[model samples]
Target: MAFHTRSNSFPSMPHPIVQEVDEHLCRLRSSEAASTSSSSICHKLSGLQDLHDCVDKLLLLPLTQQALAKEQNKKWTNELLDGSLRLLDVCSSAKDAILQTKECFGGIHRRKSLPISLLVEE
Candidate 1:
């Protein structure tokens, strides 16, 4: 039997598909940014043991949510929520790390600024 391949005449990225793809890329970028920020904060705050634990907890948030959403068969919502939660968790972990580092080194809370509130509101 001969294998057949489809013709390469498909239309270049349909408008809706392009939009969806763009949105997903943006989400992935945002998630990456958050993860980087959290890791940086953790590195800076390596002196604080509690902050390390907090960061670990936050890192698990997205994984937990994704698993639950998949079990519930909420594919679209799960994807969106997983992205959002990952971002939120990373930001939160970073903030906690920064705060703990400041507290250990300076004896006071120094919160790191982040845009997490906007996502929480949604």
Candidate 2:
């Protein structure tokens, strides 16, 4: 399946850093899926690293009272919702990558399967 791209619904532009990080993640995942051997696992690891960077950048965005007030006044942007959905898609892709890696490594124990929560935190 193709990965879903982030929606551009918000009136305000997304923090440029967010776009860069997301693009990096998408590229990493796509490349990994086309590769063989440990390279795919390495790509997934790189994607996680990029995700961490994105989180850090997101935290640095202005969350001051004035900014929050303005944000509250504006209607929920489509871009914001789209970003969230895109992140969810990334999470799913990451989980699949991990599972495939584990299976490739023969770590799958038929008697004790890992819980879904292991892939997605509740």
Candidate 3:
């Protein structure tokens, strides 16, 4: 079988999931510097969760599954599968980390009278 390289050009109109992912990423980037409060951090984590959801939707589409299944090259498919798995893993880890941070921060934020050292001692 002959192997042919495909063009990397994107369609004139991006897929809806692609657009969603872009929007979430742009929002996250724009808010990065202004994330000083717990609410802001929660909002950013929500955006990350939205991006992860977009990826999950994209991967589950029949067209995407078919494309991966039909690929003649095992290497490309393997890499794509591996990359997707890694992406999901990172997203899960990030979400958990953010939630833990929010909890700890919120706890300390709620206890305004306590010193930092006192909070740590507890």
Candidate 4:
């Protein structure tokens, strides 16, 4: 016996409110392209767009902002850490060079009572 699987998917449909908003936006653009446009109409449409954007933001998952902030903070932290590590490596190299210089000249001490500056001058 063969088993049959049923399809549970539904057809996609545009939301009525979304369709209305799109029509309103198209009308606003068309009016703007037509002869001298009134600034007040443009201002109202701008405000409406801003309100729609705010509503869209409200619908996003609560953790989205926190995740974006965390990602940016992590990027900044990595940059600071990388810069500190580079500086540390430079310091380590300088210390090694100084130590190697001292080691090379230690066996050929000309004056036992002189400071390193005087010994170097000698």
Q: Which candidate achieves the best lDDT against the true structure?
A: 3
**Residues 15-68, model 2: lDDT tens digits:** 677788778777776775476656666666667667767766664677522453
| Candidate 2 C-alpha error for residue 112, in Å | 21
As for TM-score, the candidate ahead, 2 or 4, is 2
Instruction: State the local distance difference test value for candidate 4.
Output: 0.57
* Cα-based lDDT for every prediction: 0.55, 0.67, 0.80, 0.57
Sort by TM-score, top down from the best:
3, 2, 4, 1
Q: Can you tell me which runs of candidate 3 are displaced by over 4 Å? A: 1-12, 71-122
Looking at candidate 3, the ten consecutive residues that score lowest on lDDT are 113-122
Q: Rank the candidates by lDDT, best first.
A: 3, 2, 4, 1
Better of 2 and 3 by lDDT: 3
Please give each candidate's TM-score.
0.30, 0.38, 0.56, 0.31
Task: List model 4 lDDT by residue over 1-122, tens digit each.
Answer: 99999997653765544555576566666666554333444464454565455435543535444653586578865775576567558656655765676676675564665777876754
**What is the clash count of model 1?**
0
RMSDs, each prediction?
A: 16.7, 16.2, 8.0, 25.0
Off by over 4 Å in 1: 1-74, 108-122
RMSD of 2: 16.2
| Candidate 4 local lDDT, residue 15 | 52
